[model samples]
Target: MIKGYKTQIMDYYEKIRYHERKALQERKDNIKREHPEILDLENEIGRLSIKLSMDILRHGNADDVVSKTREAITDLRVQKAELLVAYGYGQDYLSMHYQCSKCNDTGYIGTKRCSCFDRYLVKLYYKSSELAESIKTNNFNTFNLDFYSPRSDGSEKFSPRDNIEQILSYIKNDYIPNFKNHSVNMLFYGDPGTGKTFMTQCIAKELLDKGFLVIYKTSDELNKDLRTITFDNDKALEESLINCDLLIIDDLGAEQITDFSVTNFFTFLNKKLIKNKKMLISTNLLLSDLTKSYTERITSRLFGNFRLQKFYTEDIRIQKKSLRQNRFSEKTILNQ
Candidate 1:
């Protein structure tokens, strides 16, 4: 990941430098056509500066000679600015433009990363993770409460919609803001199509927009990558899984279980929990299934460290499909 990030930053710097050079060349072209003397003055200033440096190196009186040369360079710069202003251009028109003046198109300000560099990394991460596309369409604003059942059917007191609304409110108002200081992990378990995955996406999108690094992966994909690490010592995927601000493992029970898979899962989970990194896991497994599939220690850590939310509702996909079919049938009858 760091290698990829460095490569990307270098590409960005090259692109910016190219633009700066092109812009400066264009400005120089205009000056050559309309105000050729400005270029000549700039050339003279450069020559004088070089001569002053040579003189200082050749045993001239350092303080007095350097002060006189500095004054001459300052005066020449003032003339250049005056000429530029006379031609209705900014004084710094020929200066190289930078997206970040603090870093001058570099990714760092001294030893620290510039804010522009950080933002660039965040953007690159979002794009590489495929979250950029999903985040646009799956944020809190687009989430529909109508998809969840509004009324509880006998067994439950609150409706699925009500529960979801409460959860959303808590996440938006409480969880995301304090996430940097407090590590909170969540587990959403329910039947398929109960909006668990959608909720997970929603949270991921929100956290990502808030400038937190979020990684979302299905259990099958995650398992395959983890298992591959056993054969190859590549630790990039594992490092990202453990280190991102929010890790969302969707459809956790969908993976083919094996001893190695189970051990890696436990290790990954424990490492994140120990480091106080947040995670959100969505699975179709019941509490009983969770206990049966994993060891006591694994299940214990899950139950102890994660906030478990059960999504109790009918299959929303089926409901939506039926609703569409009914609408189509009604339209057909009306046409007849």
Candidate 2:
């Protein structure tokens, strides 16, 4: 992954260089066609620059010659800019352009990586995660409130749509803005196909777009990696899980439970809370079920730290499938 990231950064630099060269050549060609004398002036500047370099190399202590050459080069640059302006071009027309002037199209400023480079790495990490393609379509804008029923059931006062809307509003207004300062943990627990995972993905997409480092993994995948730490001595996945700005674990109850999983889950939750890192977990199990499966200590940490939101919606996937079938039937009838 590191190698791939490096290759991607280098590719971006190459593209910048390629476009810069192309634009410079086009400008030079236009100048040569319209004002041929400008080319002669450019050549004179280039020759003087070469001469200055040679003179400095030959007589290192020749302060007079070096000073004269420096003044001559400065004069040539002023002349070049004036000529460009006189020719109906910008004064900086011949200057080398860069996409990012801070790093001059390179991914680093000295030894540290630029913010742009960090964003690229975050994008790469998002792409490398599971269900990455869904993130493009599953953000807040694409989330449909229509899929959730607004009518209250006999047992519940608030409808699914109202509950979900409140949750979304809270996330947008409070959670995301204060994410860096607060360790806001969320637990989405409900039935399958009730948009639990969808909501988590929407949160992840929003945070990722805000340039936060979000590491998303399924509970099964996370457990498999955590298990490897004991046998294979692999710490890469563990480090990422704990250190990411936002760690999202999907389908929390679907993973195989074990002694190690229970112990590590407690440790992971405690550590993330201590570090003030945010976490979002989606699961199909209820609070009681979770308590029965995991220990009271594990459940206590989760209930104590995380804001639990129970999804009370019908199966949206089934509704979508039905809608698709209806569309297909309508198209078939139209064709007939």
Candidate 3:
């Protein structure tokens, strides 16, 4: 999973570095404005720190001067920390912060990858292969409305094609264009092979191309993550799930049903919804059937918070397979 994402991981580290650098500068500016005396002490410490290095390298400079310069810088730093604490700030308020202090948000310690990078790779591994290859052909450009018949079979008011067109229109004009400001959580519910997951992948690729972090996990994988978060205390997995631009949970009813799964899942789902994070759920279960699998409270939240979209079409995989077989038969007859 990490094989194709080396550049992306490095780019993430670069963003962290840029953010930390800018934040340090902002803190410095605030300190200078609020307390000039402390800022002056900080400046003197910086000068002596540089002078200590120069004295150590100078040929005629004695060791005594270097040691005294080092001591003076240390004493000034202690005073600065005391002042920051006295002024209702952390002792290390003026210091820079790093997401990964071991690597200083660089993703590597010297030449080797850091533990944080490995954790990122683990999260990436949960992404389904169906999604990984969906970008090449399953996007909006390749979505074929022709596969859905235009004629209504009396199942509902509109034909499959008309229904799908309405969904795609909302996706294109309303959802993707104004993703940030106009985010709406969606529940894509349907039986198997109804193109629910494919459309979800299409949206995933679209947002990812627009520079958003989209995390995809099947129900099983999400349960596994929740278990790890509950027992193993995996903060990285929890953070990724909560903070991704859009989280797509495919096949939501397939995970093993247990007390732990139900408890943790409801808690996780509520947290994300309360935070107003964008999410997409594709479930084979109907809205009414969800009560059999999950608590009524969970179903109510899903129905209340998420915009429901029902998918109904012939099994696309089977349709494609039959078409391929018909083509092969025609080719054989022509050859014979």
- Over 112-186, each residue of candidate 3 has an lDDT whose tens digit, in order, gives 878787555544543434566767787888888877888889987889889899999999998999998965999
Clashes of each: 0, 0, 0
Q: Give the CA lDDT, 0 to 100, for residue 161 in model 2.
A: 84
List the candidates' TM-scores in order: 0.84, 0.74, 0.66
RMSD of 2: 4.7
Q: What is the lDDT of residue 109 in candidate 2?
A: 98
In candidate 3, stretches whose alpha carbon ends up further than 4 angstroms from where it belongs are 1-130
Task: Report the CA-based lDDT of candidate 1 relative to the real structure.
Answer: 0.83
lDDT of 3 at 64: 84
lDDT for each residue of candidate 1 in 30-113, tens digit (9 for 90 to 100): 999999999988998998899788878875756677778878988999999999999899999978888889999888889987
Which candidate, 2 or 3, would have the higher lDDT against the true structure? 3
Error of 1 at 134 (Å): 4.4
How far is each candidate from the true structure, as Cα RMSD in Å? 3.2, 4.7, 12.8
* Candidate 2 C-alpha lDDT tens digits along 142-252: 999998888878666789889888988898899988887887789999889989888888888888888888888899977876677657765655666677788889998
lDDT (Cα) of model 3? 0.84
Please give the ranking of all candidate structures by TM-score, highest first, separated by commas: 1, 2, 3
Where model 2 places Cα greater than 4 Å from the true spot, the runs are 1-3, 29-40, 43-62, 122-132, 135-161, 177-183, 208-214, 225-245, 260-275, 291-301, 314-336
Best by TM-score: 1
At residue 80, candidate 2 shows an lDDT of: 82
